[model samples]
Target: MIAPDPLYPVLETERLRLLCPAAPDFDAMAAYLAPGTRDFVDLPPDPESAWWSVATTIGHWHLRGYGHFAVVDRRSGEHFGLVGPWFPHGWPEPELSWQLLDGAEGRGIATEAARAVLDWLFLEKGWSSCISMIAPGNARSLALVERLGARSEGMFHHRLTGELRIWRHVARTATGRKLMEGFA
Candidate 1:
């Protein structure tokens, strides 16, 4: 039962909370990023690498203003995973990225959090479009993106994550023009 960083915006869905990747989320994230057969992330198979990954996530918010949100259970305050807007170096454009802890699987946490993030990115931030890169054989991830109604544009050969299938999503609203536009 740890609290998320309050410096960043805290978004809430029906059953979860999306908060900044503060220090408290490290242990959970480390376990999720643990070395395994899964190639969900491209970090080196070293113990210290998880710390750096967590550090980078914290820095990402400072650098980009908006980054992945630590998914926490509203009632329990436990970090389930991370899901949100992500744009790292070498990426062709901003993407909707997601990763989940084992406990969070098969419970619709990713889908719920992703929808909330999409609304923030497209409706609140007024982003035009976004893409999600999924590992080739990650059925859960591929299915999640499909459920979100994203279409496969093609494969993108990431410098770190290797070749991944790209799913594209566009804002339903046309261009998200601000209501206060042209008033001044």
Candidate 2:
């Protein structure tokens, strides 16, 4: 029999743990899919849709070597959100994306998690670049992209979510290149 795939690689920041989506994380992740949190993305209304979401996230890891990570609060051991690389069917390109539960915003969690993932992608995976497709009216995400030093590369019509602004991560400078090499 073929050996089953290994689990997702775990990553950690000073205040968070980036893990693969597991069955236990479903409820917390589903909370993020609830009404107010669902605006930018096309999350369905029914609760069961969360199951499909969790399954799809897990499946993405098997289908692609990289996928979104479940963000956990290291101190509280709470599941807070997801952040990482995502490139589903019909996507314009690979994206560094994030979504946090209602109470988790304003804590710099997304930024910390995203930076770690991006660093890994660039240094370990050797990705030359990536983009974040932010919905036009998502001020919070736009701000986060700006904080990450990504520049707006103009907009595109998403097949599922309509129009979205693509923010390309800044190209590495010589110092940044040296840092990535050191990371490797």
Candidate 3:
């Protein structure tokens, strides 16, 4: 039998905790993404996809060695949303992504969590690059990637998901690692 993953550590920032998602997290995840979370995917996702979404999140820890983190309100312990790496099976590369609960918008939670994950990926994991794919119509995500200093690489059809524009950030030197370490 497979051993269980340790309880996710609390990734404490001055104002947030980017913890790993668990079964209990699904309710808040669902509620946070309510009105429509699947609609945010590049392709039309199942409206009832929360169960699989959670499983996939767990699977990331086992397979990819990293995964999306649940953004918890530091003080209240409320579940906010998630920001981290996701790679569907057989995909060429992992994508950095986020989804903030409705109330958590405009507060920079996504940006903070994403930067933290990127820093971990680079410094701790020795990854040189990571990418984010955005739908042309998703201005919010586009703006977030830009703010994170990721540049648009190009557009491509996902074959299964229609059109997607790829944005990437690569660290050639250790400079970004230092900057990211300072954020934690």
Candidate 4:
């Protein structure tokens, strides 16, 4: 396996800290995998599965040079979510995604964290664009994507997750003057 970026960044928003996933974060993330708490995102339903999920997230960094960051509350220092770029084997496109823990919703945390990650992806990583494959009927995610300025391109049937609406990210200028400018 390839070595991960030793200088992997710690992204900061006004209310959140986006850190690389670590072993200590597994239990917190796993708590969200419990029944009634899990929705939209389909994580397996056991501690071992949670371990593998966290492992896969960390491993994605080694393989792809970039991956999700564990989203933490700046004040409480809680691991509230994961957000960033992801492109696994056979993925339709490189995606910017997010998943927040219970009680973390409706706080604009995902949008803030995602804006930071998108700035890094476009400005530092030099990616031209990315996509968000939002599940149909996920109104919250659809609204978030719209808030990010991503337009709905069309639908795609994910190899694993079945049908999803593919939202294409709005392209930024070479000077990084759009989409995430306010966050930058």
Listed in order, each prediction's TM-score against the native is 0.77, 0.78, 0.74, 0.80
RMSD of 3: 6.1
On residues 18-53, what C-alpha lDDT tens digit does candidate 2 reach at each position? 876743433545544654555423576566766677
Tens-place lDDT per residue, model 3, 67-119, is 88777777987666778888986455888888775566787878877877776
Best-matching candidate per TM-score: 4
Candidate 3's TM-score reads 0.74
Give candidate 2 regions above 4 Å deviation.
1-7, 22-47, 170-174, 177-184
Worst 10 residues of 2 by lDDT: 1-10
Report, for every candidate in turn, its global Cα lDDT versus the true structure. Answer: 0.75, 0.75, 0.69, 0.76
TM-score of 2: 0.78
Model 4 worst lDDT run, 10 consecutive residues:
1-10
CA displacement after TM-score superposition, residue 182 of candidate 4 (Å): 22
Mind giving the per-residue lDDT tens digits that candidate 4 earns over 1-184?
Answer: 1114445667788888788764343354554454434441465456666766767887898788889887777798776778989998878879999988777789898899888888788767788689999998899999999998888888888668899889877558756466444432
Candidate 1 per-residue lDDT, tens place, 74-164, comes to: 8987667689888889998999998786567899999999988887777677786789999989999989999887888898997778999
Model 1 scores what on Cα lDDT?
0.75
